[model samples]
Target: MKDKPWRREQRFYSFSTDLPTRYADMDTERHVNNVAVLTLHAEARSRLHLALFGRDEWLARTHALRPAKLQTDFLEIAHYPGDVAAGVSLVSLDPHQYTLAIGLFQDGACVGLQECRIGHWHEGAWTQLPALLLDRLQRFGLTEDVQ
Candidate 1:
């Protein structure tokens, strides 16, 4: 679960939002739980979608946008009693899907990295994303030039 160099830098993310850390999210080790961090990433991703498509369009189910695959790496333990900055960027885009790169940052350092593939499904098969949607997604690409 090695993370790319740019994934550790919060400035590289095109979209970012702060999320409050909850006391219940802590584990027995006194660190924030991995599942809780993943939930933060999900919220961050939703923000990105909301920003790109607005609330109504984002919530619409006519053209379902669902995660097809996900890969995550925990780089460091996040402590409680502080806000976590969840960042998201469009890393890869295709005709039918796009990959979102997520970073969870605390105290100016990234604590985790996540890559999720979200796709549009129509009927029983994959469908091409609308050109307007693709155009909107392109505006939120990661600032870093990563391979």
Candidate 2:
């Protein structure tokens, strides 16, 4: 037999947020669409952005983080009548970019896993991460209590 592409996962993240599942996110098959899952990841990432960089600066785009690449693996189906939580972890760091892994969890199970690379943008160009930004990124972890 050929090697399996996906395997069992045992990973956690630093930040997490409960996300709403709406009728709009469901499809005819009664499952959340891939597009909706991607949106959920964005929502979680936006929270991280707000935490690391402040709301005003994030909104004003004084510094920006653009998604370079994204990949997702759907593991289970998420049902309604409850909220799902996206757990985000900063996996790797570079001078100008970083990688994040997110787990979409519902009913105590991870429905999906997402990995994305985000690059810094400043002065209309992708720039290296500043000292302050890098320091902040390195300090993030799952130390805070989770609900």
Clashes of each: 0, 1
lDDT by residue (30-124, candidate 1, tens digit) is: 99998998898889999888888888888884358888899999988998999999988887887889999889999888899999999888788
Query: lDDT per prediction?
Result: 0.84, 0.74
lDDT of 1: 0.84
- Give the alpha carbon lDDT tens digit for every residue of 49-121 in model 2: 7788788766765447788888887888876556888878787787888887777888777788877888878
Root-mean-square deviation (CA) per prediction: 2.0, 5.2
RMSD of 1: 2.0
**After superposition, candidate 2 runs with Cα above 4 Å error:** 1-11, 141-147
Residue 35's C-alpha lDDT in candidate 2?
Answer: 84
In candidate 1, position 142 carries an lDDT of 44
As a whole number from 0 to 100, the lDDT of residue 83 in candidate 1 is: 95
